[model samples]
Target: MPKRKADSVLEGVPKLPRDSSIAHHTQADYIEVNSFVTATPCDHCLDSGVPCMIDRSRRYSKCASCTRASRVCKREFYTGREWDLLRRAEDKLSSDIEKNEDELDLLEPELSALQSRLTELY
Candidate 1:
């Protein structure tokens, strides 16, 4: 990500160092759905001293509070396995669409043949 020139200029201004104690935890939606939360670092990228809060959920071990602290600490982060699962789902959907198309094509000809036979009988 590119920082705007105006934002870059602000860095020249003298500023007090951040106080890390008051930072809160954060959550990552992408990670939490697939993996269990552990005593990972805070998800939120705070000043540095913030600690992650604990979550006991079986699906998501970490709470939203920690998600805010650090991206690396996010409990809900996805692994390679989740990405593989997504790819598999997309493949299955594509296969199903192809199968339905084939079925439709077969049915259309059968329907036309049946109509023609009825007309001849009449």
Candidate 2:
């Protein structure tokens, strides 16, 4: 087949730099969600450096120190296989977190009972 002419490129859309660490301007919500990976703390505890604590008995902000609330952690292109693996890992982590939350909910009443029993004993 003969070679075809290239189509027009987008204007003013600068190429992405190889530096993943470059800071870019974005709106408030977007900026809050994405930053240099090392600089962002657990979106959950807001720099507590601890994974967020979840109690079934308590209300949780969507910002729970869970991976779902965390950063995407990638800036460059990827192979299809690599992307599949990354997505699977992310999904597994998300499920694990949900499972932990469910377990906490299931145990809340038992914890309450134990606290009451201790009070009575004291």
Candidate 3:
């Protein structure tokens, strides 16, 4: 049997293209794969006592360590000074909503009283 030549070129790197002798691996590919990994657990996971090591694949799963509906990793969106600003905005909106609800609650009886008075006047 004649000796095959392709085997010798692919001997070192298994995934390298068989047609071409060049390998196309890049540092970015390794970094992208490791993007979901964290040296420490996310704060939500840690605070909840689960200390979740969130993987990108598992972020959308029901068993994710964080309770947030957002699929985005908290580190990506809710980190640094931007996170602090988001928290402040959330708190303000919550306060405003509660205040409006309370005002509506207070208006209900008054509206009923005015309706009853109008019924009597009519």
Residue range 1-122, candidate 1, lDDT tens digits:
32887777787687753544223321344334434433334446233545444444444444444444443444445557887999999999999999999999999999999999999999
RMSD of 3: 11.6
TM of each candidate vs. truth: 0.39, 0.38, 0.39
* Pairs that clash in candidate 2: none
lDDT of 2 by residue, 1-122 (tens): 32443323444467664433232212223433542232233443554555333323333222233423344322223557878999999999999999999999999999999999999999
Best lDDT goes to which candidate? 1
The candidate 2 region of ten consecutive residues with least summed lDDT is 20-29
* Segments of candidate 3 deviating more than 4 angstroms: 1-75
lDDT of 3 by residue, 1-122 (tens): 32678767667675744432221123223333533545455556555665354435542322243333233335433446777898999999999999999999999999999999999999
Deviation from truth (RMSD, Å), model 1: 11.8
lDDT of all the models against the reference? 0.56, 0.49, 0.54
List the candidate 1 regions with Cα displacement exceeding 4 Å: 1-42, 45-77, 119-122
Q: If both were scored by TM-score, which would come out higher, candidate 1 or candidate 2? A: 1
* Candidate 2 Cα deviation (angstroms), residue 89: 0.4
Residue 33, model 1, lDDT: 44
